[model samples]
Target chain A: MTAGVPVEPGTVRIAVDLLGGDGAPAVVVDGALRAFGADPDLHLLLVGPPEAADELLGVVHPADRERISVRPVQRGVAMTDDPRRLSRADTTVRAAVAAVVDRTADAVVSAGATGATVTAAVLGFGRWPDVRRPALIATMPALAGPVVLLDVGGSFEARPGTLARHAVLGAAYATVVHGVAHPRVGLLSVGTEAGKGDRARRAADPVLTLAPLPPGAHYVGLVEGYDITSGDRADVIVTDGFTGNILLKGIEGAYAMAGGPPASGGAPRAAALLGVAGTVVVCHGAARDDDLASGIALAAHLYRRGATAAISGLLADHARDGHLTGPGTAADGPGRTDHGADERTEETP
Target chain B: MTAGVPVEPGTVRIAVDLLGGDGAPAVVVDGALRAFGADPDLHLLLVGPPEAADELLGVVHPADRERISVRPVQRGVAMTDDPRRLSRADTTVRAAVAAVVDRTADAVVSAGATGATVTAAVLGFGRWPDVRRPALIATMPALAGPVVLLDVGGSFEARPGTLARHAVLGAAYATVVHGVAHPRVGLLSVGTEAGKGDRARRAADPVLTLAPLPPGAHYVGLVEGYDITSGDRADVIVTDGFTGNILLKGIEGAYAMAGGPPASGGAPRAAALLGVAGTVVVCHGAARDDDLASGIALAAHLYRRGATAAISGLLADHARDGHLTGPGTAADGPGRTDHGADERTEETP
Candidate 1:
């Protein structure tokens, strides 16, 4: 849209939910200020009550005031609010997504209720052409390199078709976002043996083996939980959100128990929401100031790379020819059939 | 019946699966010898090929050879063998369970496929009257005593009745095995907040809250992944096998990534097979020498305390008073139906 201006190369705009997460505006404000000071070109669209926004505006220097903006929402989707309450427009997360949809910001970030953010994004930016369930992908810094874990807390479907689709999304994301060459993908299971794992994992195994992957990604059969940290067996680990979310949190807890994370970095506190039309990052619900800053930086990084549009374009191109389903499997029901299809996308190039 | 003698008080007999795990026979023999030497009164029933059992026999002194018995099963199950092959009698794990059933061995331990060991125990020792899917329970050594995790890799069904049954088993096991004065049971979810998990979890939560726990156990609603490692929220955390399996392995992987395990201990590699009428323990499929030894020791510990029989009695007494569900409920379809018929017990106390 900016004609090769690279969207927000030097200037990155991140819309943050002021009243999101367990700590809310207090911690959110602290994190926004920290992120603002760390990145000279970083701008924030604080989305919450005016009082909360004023707290951050009062702290930042007048010189950096130009980099800060506010889109004050009257209220936030309370943590205790019913999932149906997400339809309300006055919610902070909904307003934050509006900033992105309106092109007032480059990306959106929140540590609020995952369901609300997902609902808002799906409603605001609209699902990608074929993505039924928008996935929350987290990249953990493993022993070898970055390991891309998808569906951290998005869809919870265990259908073989859903898993196979995630494998494609994961592979493409690794290549486009992480710059990995020929990412080896593995299905998380109890054992490495072919027939191991629950019903869904077993059914998905054969499908993935036969289902051709995007360029620079190959199926490496079954892998175990160790692969998430070791990064020895595969670069991309695909799992349903239920398992991924539990695994992610378990790893975080383990790091806490073991004094601290490894020198190679601990479990990521932030995750990028993939499959949505906009770039969104989500930190833990109990995020600290440092965690929030990391989320901000991740949003900045995703914005700088134009990851949303680029990945969307790649998917679009791939889906235009309907090649996303690979060779000869064209009869597969609606691209997002079996899974929850929250981030439905087309089988395009 | 152990001759009504104390069995030397610490005199424990464990059936070690010599042909189990990735590095079997050699590693199993080495691990058994280490466990034997570590515990002076420990006895072993080494099950596998004659040559594998002979490997251990050649090392120990002739006077102590009586502590070591051999059950020669020539055929060994490969890692890739079909899960149905678990019913085969020639496998070492089956032989180990047979030794326990025949009263030659006190308990069975194997680092073989979980399906194989589970099936062997079910067929040999019979199922607990009230349980359908025998839950695999593992105790993690946490800073705060021990955290008991159930259905780590047993049945993967997510039905509410299964979860409730597993809760009873977990709580009873916590009291009988871990000796916790009063175990606090919890449902594992993404957050401690109510209604925070997938449909299966949400459906199981209320059922667990109202389900009749053992005499000294109480349900503490839901706990997060952090609770699993910190042991701050509950003593016994229960979930479907699929999630529990991944979470357990993920913790193990995280600890490995953190250089080593914490000061207390690491993720448990051995899981005590509960729900079966006899004491059985399953080690990691990729177990090492030390891990295999730990599994053997765990089985011996269970047998020594009469853990299986005691836990079974607890469930049986509770079921007789119109507390537990029927066989149909215990093995009901997915979705965890909270409202179910209170029928007669399938397995008698």
Candidate 2:
């Protein structure tokens, strides 16, 4: 799916959390309208209060009325809300995820608290068999091409096993969604040298080097932060969510400070969720109308590309071949499988 | 020490590592010359092979030769060299540190491997009594005057105690060096909300909130990555070395991609070493001549302002008042004191 080209032929039903962002409802309505106007084949399942959904429906032409639907979730998770509240079915983000699980929508999109959305998605659509922790993968417009960075906020722990698994998820996403051939995956660290980072990076480096990647994808040792924008060292950069999330925002802020982004594009405000059974896209909490629109487009693009199933199928194929019994796989036992489960109680929304 | 203003009144002697960076003697020699020419009171003690030092001496006027001294250290640490080799006295970075220890130079500046320089500084100058882990602090020219970011590459672990201490160190540095009255100190996390970060950050938040800061400094809770560039949230941003190093470079890369940095200034390539008893500045390993010159100037500026001594004295005063008896202090016991000592064997230079 090429960026800047708004039109695509496939009809993608997206369940958008109308009360997700800091600007919520108003921006979501405006963004949904912009996205709806841009794409002729787009369908939105507005999951929020009826008043907010009606605001969007009232603006669109009568002929487009049939394409939009409302789930009417009165409650929306607050940015300061506890993530545990996502378990409630009435929350807009959880209701959005429910739309996907019930087959009412093709994908899910939200600008809500990341932990809440991740939790709702995991509860609504279970994780893939071989995968434990899911990752949020963002595509950066780099000098070379699109650079895929993962675990932006899906998982915060810097586990070596999780990083190794993210490498697989990033490579598969790059290849399947971005259409990159033989994507070079690199673990993000302080320096490109073998042991140039903290304890977590030092431990993850060798694991990533040895872990089997999807066909046409290879591990490129270690890479520094410059590789994220320059894209000279690797096509997919894997890092812990804590670092990746901060770096992503840091880049966005730098771009803002420098007047604007480069000609190619700027840091993405939206990211695709990987390792879940359904397609999911997350936008920044402070997303503007354009950012929210871009996120909706990204969700539609992922759904149309069949990225979730294709990437899962690739990992399952590798698992059947005995190549996926590594640290992050099911073979690591029940203890490791509790990746996002514990965070529901520990994390804030 | 104001940026862009090249000249200072006091004569500050800096020990330059001629064989440090990826470009080694060429850029170091060129940068040393640029720094020497810019500041009339700058005295450089060239610490490298006689041949490399003589290359700089050859071009200067005979009368100016008196200000330049040569230490004639033939050995230099390679980027891929073992960090433990810093224990050797002959390497350029170590010899440069020795110049400060023996009062031959007021400060040391190097573009050598960060871990090596950090280890060498710890061994040569010894960490401050109350500071178990030394931190590398870089001042970014933000929309506000300057934002001080700590642990850029000194310590990599994300221990809660370490972060709390670094907050104290950063607050002291900002107040003493940058002259920010009532500096707002912030713990770098994923979000501004109280509990919006990883396990380390979650644990570090309360500790920092309760940790007694230097006089005229106050804890401002958690801040996001955007604050580093915006400088709207906090004057001092504290983070682990792993995250800080990557974020610093990420901002640099974004600025490069955006054509150039904003009108304020670009991301800093040089960072000052805090917690060490002597003044030292570390340049990026891939530093260009201008960056190297900036690093040298930064070292001279630190020396002229007596930053190291003043910050340390402030912390010492706090320690005397029992405010420093927390997790990172000598009271934390010997286990915590071995911060940089163990990394000598584990890390690569």
Q: Give me the candidate number with maximum TM-score.
A: 2
Q: List, residue by residue over B49-133, the lDDT tens digit for candidate 1.
A: 8888888889899998999988878877777776556679888888888887788888888887777788888889888876788
TM-score of each: 0.92, 0.95
Off by over 4 Å in 1: A1-9, A325-349, B1-8, B330-349
Find the 10 residues in a row with the least total lDDT in model 1 chain B: B340-349
Fnat of each prediction, in sequence: 0.55, 0.60
**CA-based DockQ, model 2:** 0.52
Specify the highest-DockQ model's number: 2
Clashing pairs in 2: none
Q: Provide interface RMSD per model, one decimal.
A: 7.7, 4.7
Predicted structure 1: lDDT: 0.78
DockQ, per-model, please?
A: 0.41, 0.52
State in Å the error of residue A124, model 2: 1.3
Q: Which number leads on lDDT? A: 2
Chain B, per-candidate TM-score:
0.91, 0.93
